[model samples]
Target: MRTIAYFLVITLICCLAPSADLSAQLNEPAPIRLRNASFEDIPRNSRAPVGWYNCGFPAETPPDVHPDPMNQFQVGMGPQHGRTYLGMVVRDNDTWESVGQELSEPLVAGQCYDFWINLARSKVYLSQSRVSNKPANYVTPAKLRIHAGYDFCDRQELIGESDMVRNYNWQEYAIKLSPTEDYTHLVFEVFYETPTLIPYNGNLLLDNASTLIPSPCEEVVAVNSPLVNDDQKEPISTDPVPGPVVVTQPTTKSGDPQPDPEPQVQLGQSKQVLAVDAVFEVPDITFVANESELTPESSASLQEIVDFLTIYDNVIIEIGGHASQKATADFANRVSMRRAGSVVEYLRTRGIDPRRMFPKGYGKSKPVCYDESADCKRRNQRVDVKVLKIE
Candidate 1:
């Protein structure tokens, strides 16, 4: 009789376990999501992308949706991803362009997030200068400023700022954000090199943004991590996203750690010919959470594949997107399939022949690692290239 009662108790606990899990899930905070994150829209001058609101300086022109196709400003760089990218300029008159959006969820206070965005420069951003009426090429490099605010265009606190983005090639920048207060809006804006008395014409190109993935406070480089410092003082304000806010607080007293230096990856390297069945693992592929879009940093490795294909013209290949073990086989398959399709689309934009490439998804059946830790799971989420045929 005691054995039967023990079995009944075990069954009761098992029945309630699912309900407890569901309740915990319901109590979790909703992730903050950005709308139209890739900035896809009709390319136009002085227009913000579809979902982002224009928050440029008062009376100044708004940020631009680039690759205008008409090429009025002499800027015609193709986007790293999607149809159009963003073009923001810091004018000689000290004004700049920016754009903003309300978050899907408010950023909680004292939360640390790992944010990533792709930034580049246009060498031929021709526009009439505010200082001189003649057309000036906005070729100088500029920095990026990200901000969180209570309302549209309100600069409540500066979250992330970047060094001068000098590379013309697209590269992903990981910006660490530490917010002290809960906020609902985020802004991205362009600013000039710091410690300069005079502002000059400069341009910044933006594409392929990542969602703010919650991260351990001690990972990578620490920028504005509240865990490191005890005081609640504001670091020097470079500028906020959407617009530049005049700094009202004191700048850091020299000893505080500066932002991590910009990452540099040389593009356009030659590659050896790939034979059939040769599997090449791309080391830099990172995607937005739950989305298949490749981050800008993936360009470095993706370019190698392009170079390989361009040289070995007869090689046919398969692109496979793999995911970690999921709840069901069908769910894993669908996720991997979408990721593979996104890579194919990116290659197509770069002039790769669609006929020579096949997209496949491996799902959880093939994980690079089975440890099941978060880092290991991230490693398991990957894209692989297999030479299918050598025509």
Candidate 2:
């Protein structure tokens, strides 16, 4: 009887142990599903993916899905999780490509979650091909930024940005998000670290983007999917230290003609001007192709110039307008002149004295890039500001 009782007690303990384990597994949070997460459903040549929208201008080049056999840009590591992935370009025209999508569900405020994506840099991204003379210019390397916002195409809150991914191999990047506000949209952007730096042409490849998953367990699941190599392990940092967060003020929607509030300028103060050798070019002041009309997006950058002139009353500047090789030399020269004159007129309206400003058009005489690529042409067609005199 004593032996039988001992056997029964052991069996009961074993049964209870399995039941407890089953209950714990049931409590674990399920993984969130991201639509078109692997970028596999889209057509090969489509500019925009099926579940994503172009965050940039319609005229600008949109982000494309890769495995570009036609352009022969398939030499690098393939998609980290599927047959296709996203490709974006930051062109010398100061225009960068971005794509965004509405999340399956809004991120709950104050909830800690894990997010990740696979990133790569294509060594040979063909921007344009010329049948005669100069050949194509490959895109360079640039940083990739991911953002979260409440509205469509908004980048009000930066989530994470990878260090310039120059390697041709695919790398997994991860970040933790603890949102202060509910966010429904996510954006992928290409930008220079500093706005004052000269714009360059570059390409960023994206894939295996996962949605924010609630993480109660300390262990994070590897981000690799079936398409990735079975032997390859997702890079994970244990007890990683969080970095500083950067948040940007929301920008005015494009095409809104209403100007932003101008800075207060005090008159009669001793004039302070930049050094005579200082030459600063406005990075965001751009125009439509072949047209001198300033884009509405140029308002913020132009405002900065206005504030600078107000402080330096004794300074004089020369605005030089240039054009790409998109048109005949004579036509390019005429349009370039008009472009420079437009800037002068804008400054004049903002209370800058006409005597302190000189506007000149160089046409296509000086080219930033001699190659006949699209990015090269955009770089060549620009307006530069030089400080001529600082009395």
lDDT of each: 0.74, 0.66
Model 1 misplacement above 4 A: 1-30, 221-391
User: For model 2, what is the error of residue 295's alpha carbon versus the real structure, in angstroms, after optimal superposition?
Assistant: 43
Q: Model 1 compared with the native: what TM-score?
A: 0.51
Per-residue lDDT of model 2, residues 295-326, tens digit only: 99878767666656753556798988888877
lDDT of 1 by residue, 230-322 (tens): 373222223223212122121233323234323222223312334567677776677887778889988877766664564355679898888
Candidate 2's C-alpha runs over 4 A off are: 1-31, 72-77, 128-138, 215-391
User: In model 2, what lDDT does residue 53 have?
Assistant: 77
- Please count the clashing residue pairs in each candidate, in the order shown: 0, 0
> How many Å off is the CA of 279 in candidate 2?
66
Model 1 per-residue lDDT at 223 = 30
